[model samples]
Target: MTGSGHISAFSARRAALFALLSGAFLACLALLVSPPPVPEMKSSAIPPPLRADRQVEPSFVHHFGRKHDEATWFKSDFYYPNSGHPAWQADLIHFKKNRVELEVRRRKVAYKNIAGAEYQRRGFYHYGRYEVVMRAAPGSGTVSAMFTHTHGQFGDPHDEIDIEFLGKDLTKMHANYFTNGREHGGIYIPLGFDASKEVHLYAFEWEPGAIRWYVDDRLVHTATPADMAIPQAPGRLMVHLWSGTRDQFNWHGEPTFRNGARARFYCLSYQAAGDDTEQCSDSYTPRKYRR
Candidate 1:
C-alpha cells in the first residue's frame, strides 16, 4: 500500500510540470502570431506632398477696429523695423476710434534713436493684390509704407515690393521693387493731392511676371520682368512708420519731429491669384489726381 501511494504522488508531480510547460509554450505562440502596433507619426515628419492638401493660404480683409487683431497681425518690436535705423516700440502703436495709429517720436535723450511702430501680417503670401486705406504720416524724413518683403527667412532671396511715402513730399507716391537686396530704381507718381491729409486706397497687384500699382483703383504704374526680375519669393505684408537719418536727405529728407508724427490705417485687404472675391470696400473715395 505504501509503494502504490508513492507512485501516484510521483505521477501527479510529473503531470503538473507538463501543464506548466504547455501554458508557457501557448503564450510564446500567441506572441509570435500577433501583429505589432503602428508607431505614431509626428506632424514634422510628414513630407510636403502628403501635407499639401492640408495647407491653406491666408486670404482675407482685415478691418482695423478698436483693437488690432492679434490672430491676424503682429506688432513688431524689433530694433530696426523694416531694416530702417529707427527702433520699434510696441507701445507706439495704438488702436482707437476704429483705426490703427502708428506713432513715431524723436527721443530727446538719444535724438538719433527714433521710436517707431510697425505691424505685419502673420501669414506669408504669394502673388496677390495687396491694398491699404491709410493716411500717410506727414513729417520731413518720416516714411509711412505698406509693402511685401522677404528677408531670405525661408531659403529665398531678399525680395520686396513697396508703396512708400516720403513725408518730404506727400503729393508723390513712390513705387519700388527689389530682388536679392538690390533696388530696381523706383518711380514717383504725382498724386496731385496730399496723402497725409485724407485716407486713400493704395494697392499693388503682384503677378508671376508683372507688377502693377494703383491709387484708388486707377492704374498708376506697371512693371514687367523686362523692367526687372519679378520677385518670386513669398513674403509678409507690412506697414510701418519710421524716420530716416540726415544721410538719406537726398531720398527721405531730414526728419524734423517738432511734434510727434502718426499714420492712421483703416483697412488692409489681400486677394490671392485666381481669386475674384472683393474682400473689402474702400472707406473713402480717393481724391481725383490733377496730373
Candidate 2:
C-alpha cells in the first residue's frame, strides 16, 4: 500500500508538470500569432503643441498624367544612412502612363541597402484636408505611405499624420500621428478590400480640435484632442514606398524581393482650413461611413 501511494503521488506530480508546460507552450504560440500591440499615448511623452494658424486660400491639386510640376513637387534624391534600410533614389520615381510610380527595388549590396522612391510637395501646409488617390504595394516587408511630415524643420518639433499600408497585410490600413517625435495615436482599420488590388481614395482632415481619417470618403476613424494633443506644426505632403529591415519583421513581415514592388499615385489634393471647395474632384463615389 505504501508503494502504491508513492506511485500515485509521483504520477500526479508528473501530470501537473505536464499541464504547466502545455499552458506555457500555448501562450508562446499565441504571442507569435497575435498582432503587435498598438502603442499607448503617454502624457509625459507629449510635447507642447505648436501654433498653426489657418492659411488663407491655400489649395492645390495635381493629377499625375505625364509629369509632376517641378515648381511645386520635388522628387526626393536623398537617403538616410542611419535608417539601415532602403535609400531614396530619384530614378526610382517614375511619371509615366498617367500615374506616379514609386518603386522599391532590392539591391545587391552590403548591409541590406535597397532603392526606394519618395515625392514631396514644396513648402509646408497648415490645418487642412489632404487627399490621395492611390494603390498600395503588395509584398512582405514593404510600406506604402501617404503622410504629412515636418521633421523638426527650422527647429519646429517633429509632427506628422500618417496613412500607411504594411505590405504584409494590405487589407489593414494603419493610421498614426506623432507630436514632437513621440507617437500618440496608432490604429489599424480593417479595410474590407485589399488596398493593393485597386486604387482607392484616402484622406484626412486635420483641424485644431480633431483629426478625421476617411477611406473612399467614408469616415473611418476620428481622433480628438481628448485622445491626445492634435498635431499643430505645418508639414509637407509626401508619399514613399520603402522596405523594412529584418529586425522589423515582427511589425512588417520579412521582405521577399524576387519581383520588387511599386505603389501608384493617381492624384493628390489639399484644401486649407475654411476653404469652401476642394481643389479638384475625382469620379470615385463617396461611401457611407462605417465603424
Candidate 3:
C-alpha cells in the first residue's frame, strides 16, 4: 500500500509538470504565429521660406523658371550640361570641342529635389543671341529639353528666354519668351528639315524686341516686337539642359522599371538671346510677339 501511494504521488506530480510544459509550449507557438504591429510613419520636416521682396536680389537674378536640379534636369552628352550653373561659374555647356556644336541625349530621370539655384541660372547676366541645337527623343509624350530661365518666379518679374525640344514629335521644338511670371509666352515650330536622325542647329537672333527662331541657320518662327514681357529693367541669362518625367508632358506614359530604355536630344548649337525682348521703336513694323 505504501509503495502504491508513492507511485500515485509520482504520477500526479508528472501530470502537473506535463500540464505546465504543454501550456508554455502552446503560448510560445501562439507568439510565433502572430505578426508584429507596424510602426506609424513620420512626416518630413519643412524648410523655412525665403523672404519676398528680397527674393529678386542680385545674388539670384537669372535662372530657369522651370524647377529642376542639376542632376534631375540635365545629364551629360559630350559637353552639353542641363539646367543652370552657379553665380561665379561660366556655364559653357554650349560649345562642343570649343565650337558651337549642340548635340546630346535627353531622357527623363526621377529624383526628389530639383533646386535650380546653384548650377548657373541665378545671377546677373545679360546679352547676345541664344540658341539650342539638338534632336528630339525617339519616343512620344516628352523627350528631353534645354532651357534659359530667369529669376522672375522667385524674385521680381525679370526676363526669361528658353529654347526647348520635345520628344513628342521629332520634327518640332518649343520656344518660350517671358519677363516675370506675368508675361506668359511660347511657340511650337515644325522643323522643315529632319532633326530626328542627324544633328541640326536651333538658333535664335535676340535683338531688341525681336526674338527670332531659326532651324539649321534658316529663319522659321519669329517672336517680333510687341508689348509683351521681356526686357526687364536689368536682367540675366541662363544656360541649362535637363529631362522631365512627369505625366503632364510625358506622352510615352510614365516610365517604369520594366520598359526598355530610350533617350532624346543632341544639342548642336547654343547662342545667348539678348535685349530683344523690349518693346521696339514705333518706326519699325516689328514682327508680332503676341496676338
Residues 1-291, candidate 1, lDDT per residue (tens digit)? 699999999999999999999999999998899754433323332112212332335678888878766666787764622344676667889987767889998862123468888888766777889888888999788889999887643345789999989988989999999988888886999998999887888999999999999988899999998888999877767899988666677788777744579998888889999887665453445453111
Sum up the clashes in candidate 2: 0
lDDT computed for candidate 2: 0.77
Q: Model 3: which ten-residue window has the lowest total lDDT?
A: 109-118
Residues 199-223, candidate 3: write the lDDT tens digits.
Answer: 4545565666666676656688776
Number of the top candidate by lDDT?
A: 1
Question: Each model's C-alpha lDDT?
Answer: 0.78, 0.77, 0.41
For model 1, where is the 10-residue window of minimal lDDT? 45-54
Clashing pairs in 1: none
How many pairs of residues in model 3 come into backbone collision?
A: 44
Q: How far is 55's C-alpha from truth in model 1 (Å)?
A: 6.5
| RMSD to the hidden true structure, all candidates | 17.6, 14.8, 13.1
Best-to-worst lDDT order: 1, 2, 3
